[model samples]
Target: MFDEGVIKFSCEWQKTEPLAFSGLETLMGWRDRIFAAGLIGLYPNGIGYGNISLKLTDSSFIISGTQTGHLLHTEPQHYTLVDRWDIDRNSLHCTGPIKASSESLTHAAVYTLDSTIQAIVHGHSAALWQQYLNVLPTTRASVPYGTPAMAYEMGRLFQEEGLAQKRCLVMAGHEDGLLAFGETLEQAATTLLALKQL
Candidate 1:
């Protein structure tokens, strides 16, 4: 069940005008289109797909909505804020209206683990997911999604597999999904798009 109030709040936040970055906006737009196209192509059979999320300076993050499909056709504000946990504001108790993607915690975790990471992207692709699952036994237990436990597991995996230095991993339970993060949105989006080719 989607909460209307949260949606409205998130929409408002996204609508708030900001200083323009024509060059960055142009690049991000191109990245979004490329990433979206790659996702669509990878999921041609259409089992699942992925989207991008970005962390701005004010602690608010821009995340694509749940089940929005790829990223190309979606409106800009369709990307909403997953609240920043403001410790001074009784963060845990302060639940605002807009509901971010169910995997918002994953995005949050990446930023929390590394302040340098400005963007994160998660997606579902058949080959990549299959390869990840096939290699899971060689790694530790499978990586899950949509839960705090999974986020913790991912953190552990990052440290153990030396993926902390890298910016991506495959979420086994999500069925064809991969996670990628980077110092900038373009880097993350580019990595995600390239992973499909590798």
Candidate 2:
């Protein structure tokens, strides 16, 4: 109970101006659809689940802020920029009106794995997780979410489990957790949407 939305890393957060909404139109639009689909939403415990992110550079990205899943809609202020992260140290540095999402490090791991991966969508769905668990490149259940172990597990998936080609994997230890990523936000979101049909 109450396992989601807690930041597991040492985050250096700076309160700054809200991010401009210009380049986020596509991300936000897909987020709206994902939330409406009940993929990213509030749990009964009031903890928000799921997060969306886009690569801004090789080392920087914009992600929906932590605990923002309760919102039916989000604004620029609800997002943050993760400018730096050290997965081995389990540390992150970000700037925005809000802190980065709890899954920032995991997203950071994905970006670090490949230069072409430009977007990542982390969401929850019992059916999808159950149906695809182990059938897809999956993390071991021993690794918890938002930690260096989990981040490394992502690397394992890519190096050993063909995750880059699969483009999605189940977080076996993280209940109902699934991540989809691609070269574009559209591909990332569509990958998750496609899983709903299987």
Candidate 3:
């Protein structure tokens, strides 16, 4: 299996200063909550296990930096802007103090589904994944995470599985991986939280 937290796409990163916290306030707040719940954290193997993103524009977004999940709290530098991406090319461009999360392309896939979708929260929960696999809009177990194939699965779900209304899905190929998204950060965060009760 592909290791968690590994970037599968060709990333073109321009290291720069951290972003201002003005637009990231809400995103960071929910991040802290999910981290506290153990949905986002470092595995015993030292690899991180989750990421979140906020759409900045039609083609850009602010995503949690790779490997930052171990931190109890993250600063502005822990996030990076995905300036551009090409799903078919399996490439991404980003800028900030740190590189974008490995899951950036998957988030990019979701954002492209609707301009109204503003936030995406990707977390790890074995219970949730096990309980919801195939029940929720789930990507194929043969399709790995953080790659163009996985990204395309999002499109399949939207077109055929009613993912637009469900707003959350399971990644069967990526152990414990779940994605929740909505027009606002709160909605996305709340949707993720509600999954625990299912």
Candidate 4:
């Protein structure tokens, strides 16, 4: 879950920055909704995966750190910030020493491919994953994560499911997990919740 301090900090950061009001409000609103929905967890089968992030600028974005959970309770400054592949440093940056989530690259890819997408949420949900596995052809066995290959596979599925308007995908090999993106964080969160209810 998100810390109160973090939520407050995020609110302040958005107010001080040149970001859009709707996007920031959506991000903050989802932070609360995801936590209240009990979507973040630590147990093996628990829904402990996923992060929400917002674009700070065209070439840069801010995302929750690895395993940080959907609800960020800490200060916003504590969250990780990532940028396009450096023409020089060759690595992304984070607020602390911790590495960003492996799926960070996936988030980056979504933003790169869809300029309208302002928020991205990725999580492991038993219900959604089960649906994907039950529906996917048996010939496909494994699903990749945090890799370009996985992104491509998901992109194909998105097309197949007529989900381009929805912008969400479930990974059959990854199990009980899915990724959702939207023009705002609220939309992404709402889509994820809707899938879980189904």
Q: Which digits, one per residue and each the tens of the lDDT, describe model 4 over residues 18-137?
A: 223234555556755765665543444333466677876777776665556633453443255665533122234444333455566666666766678888877665755677554532
Residue 148, model 4, lDDT:
55
Candidate 2 structure quality by residue, lDDT tens digits, 64-83 = 99998888888888899999
Per-model C-alpha lDDT, please?
Answer: 0.56, 0.93, 0.91, 0.56
Which stretches of candidate 4 lie above 4 Å from their native place? 1-29, 44-48, 70-72, 86-91, 95-98, 132-141, 158-161
Candidate order by decreasing lDDT: 2, 3, 4, 1
Model 3, position 136, has a per-residue lDDT of 92
Better of 2 and 4 by TM-score: 2
Worst 10 residues of 3 by lDDT: 20-29
Clashing pairs in model 3?
A: none
**Native-to-model Cα distance after best TM-score fit, residue 40 in candidate 4, in Å:** 2.4
Candidate 2: give the clashing pairs.
none
Off by over 4 Å in 1: 1-31, 38-48, 85-98, 132-143
How many clashes does each candidate structure show, in the order listed? Answer: 2, 0, 0, 10
* Per-prediction TM-score to the true structure, in the order listed: 0.69, 0.98, 0.97, 0.69
